[model samples]
Target: MRGYVAMTAQEVAEFMASGLFDVSDVYAPTSQFIVDHQDLDDEEIEYTLSMVAAEDALEMKTATSGAACVLAFEVPAESISESHDMSISLSSPLKWESLECLFEVSSDGEELTWYATQEIDANLASWLK
Candidate 1:
């Protein structure tokens, strides 16, 4: 399944350096999310949800003090378990085997810029410099 994770820029760099990635929380397109966003097409819904998750990630980073980013990755379907709420949790930490995309959410209301997995390192380097 495809999911979005909230990650710090440091975390992203570490994952790239070490080839490992793990996080307890992931946001996905749950049934409730579909119901809440009935007006959008499937692609639109997914994009909308991803942006919402990205915004939330920024808030989390603010509380902890770091640069916030969102990672879009594909994981085994069985690895994820949906919670009673809208979010989902992973069974275990994931390796770098399935990352697909990345997003930079610098602040609220700004458009998010997406980066492909292959483009991440260069983008991160530029962002850091």
Candidate 2:
């Protein structure tokens, strides 16, 4: 399953160094998500969910005083379990091996600029310093 994870820029740097990404909550396309977005196709639904997650991440950034970004990853279907609410939880930490892409959420919360896997390290280097 493809999922989105919100993290601070510092967190992104740490994950890059450790080669592991662990978060209790990840936003993914769950059964409830699909049911909620019956009008859209799979790809569109994923994008919509990602934007919502990005907004939450932006709030986290403000509360924590750090830069916020969203990560796109691919994990096994069995790894994800739905929560009572709209979000889902991962059975275990997702590894860098599953990473697919990254999104830098704009400060104004109006845009999400994508970063490919190969570009992430350099982007973090610039953002952190």
| Model 2 bad stretches (over 4 Å) | 62-66, 83-85
Error of 1 at 56 (Å): 2.3
**Candidates' lDDT values, in order?**
0.75, 0.81
TM-score of 2: 0.88
Question: 16-126, model 1: which lDDT tens digit per residue?
Answer: 888877678677777777787789888997687678777777777744344678888887777776552456788877777789888888666367788888898777765
Quality of model 2 by C-alpha lDDT: 0.81
Model 1: how far is 36 from its true place, Å? 3.3
Candidate 2 lDDT by residue in tens digits, 63-118: 44457788888977777765534567888888988999989888887889999999
Residue range with the least summed lDDT across 10 consecutive positions in model 1: 58-67
Candidate 1 residues lying further than 4 Å off, grouped into runs, are 62-66, 83-85
Report per-prediction Cα RMSD to one decimal: 2.5, 2.1
Q: Which candidate has the top score in TM-score?
A: 2
